[model samples]
Target: MILEHRTYTFKPGTVDKWMKKYEAEGLPIQKRHLNRFVGLYVSEIGVLHTTVLMWAYDSLADREARRQAMYADPDWQSFIAEIWALDAILQQDVMIMNPAPYSPPV
Candidate 1:
């Protein structure tokens, strides 16, 4: 399986706002189009104001297809537009990882 890890860093004190908005609006659309939802988290120690989102997919192609569908969906577009309007995000990073043989199933 492949896991997509997304990390977003926002300005100070904006994480909660972003999370709330995502939970209320974005999560529903993502839940419908995306693969397995691994977890959502906020950094508490180093690099404060960071949020991490992880999703599991059967393969890279599956991930790409699902993401493309999500991007095409109007609800997702609206959610992202709201997020961008907030202007709180500072940086974002994404990684697709292969789990070790010994790792537990995602």
Candidate 2:
């Protein structure tokens, strides 16, 4: 299995604002398109004002297809526009991970 790890660092005090918007709007649209949703988290110590999102996919192709569909959705497009307008994010990091041979299924 493949895991997609997305980390978004929001501007100092804007994390709560961003999270509120995401939960109210983006979450539903994203959930409709991506099925292997894993979890969402916020940093407690090391990196303040950062959110981490995890998603599992069968393969890179599956991830691409699912994300492409989400991007194509009008609701998602509108949400992206709103997020950009909010200008709350400072940086974003994405990583594609492969499970270790001995690791349990996620």
Candidate 3:
């Protein structure tokens, strides 16, 4: 599986608002097109006022396709624009990583 991870840092004192907006709008849209949300989170440590959204896909191609579709969707564009104007600053990243190897019980 491919993991797409992003973290958003909300301005001080705006975490609640950010989470509310995400729950009401962002999550639904993501569920519609992505349908593969492993988890979404609000950090309680390190970057206390930040959020993380993780999604899993079958492969890199699948991830690209989902991203392209989300970008082309009008709802996503506007939703992002609204958040980009406030509650977020200098905190966004995407990383694709491979899972670490593990041995079965001997």
Q: Best TM-score goes to which candidate?
A: 1
Q: How far out, in Å, is residue 5 in model 1? A: 0.7
Q: What is the TM-score of each candidate against the true structure?
A: 0.98, 0.95, 0.84
Report the C-alpha lDDT of model 2 over 1-106, residue by residue, as the tens digit.
Answer: 8999999999999999999998999998998888678988999999899999998899999889999999999999999999999999999999999999998888
The better-scoring model by lDDT among 2 and 3 is 2
lDDT of each: 0.96, 0.92, 0.78
lDDT tens digits by residue: candidate 1, 1-106: 9999999999998999999999999999999999999999999899899999999999999999999999999999999999999999999999999999999998
The candidate that wins on lDDT is 1
Off by over 4 Å in 1: none
Q: Write the per-residue lDDT of candidate 3 for residues 1-106, one digit (tens) a residue.
A: 7677887776788888778888999888888888478888888878687888888887898888887898899999999999887745656777876555562211
Using lDDT as the yardstick, the better of models 1 and 2 is: 1
Cα error of candidate 3 at position 39, Å: 0.9
- TM-score ranking of the models: 1, 2, 3
Q: Show how many residue pairs clash in every candidate, following the order shown.
A: 0, 0, 0
What TM-score quantifies how close candidate 1 is to the native fold?
0.98
Which pairs of residues have clashing backbones in candidate 3?
A: none
lDDT ranking, best first:
1, 2, 3
Clashing pairs in 2: none
Candidate 2 stretches greater than 4 Å from native = none
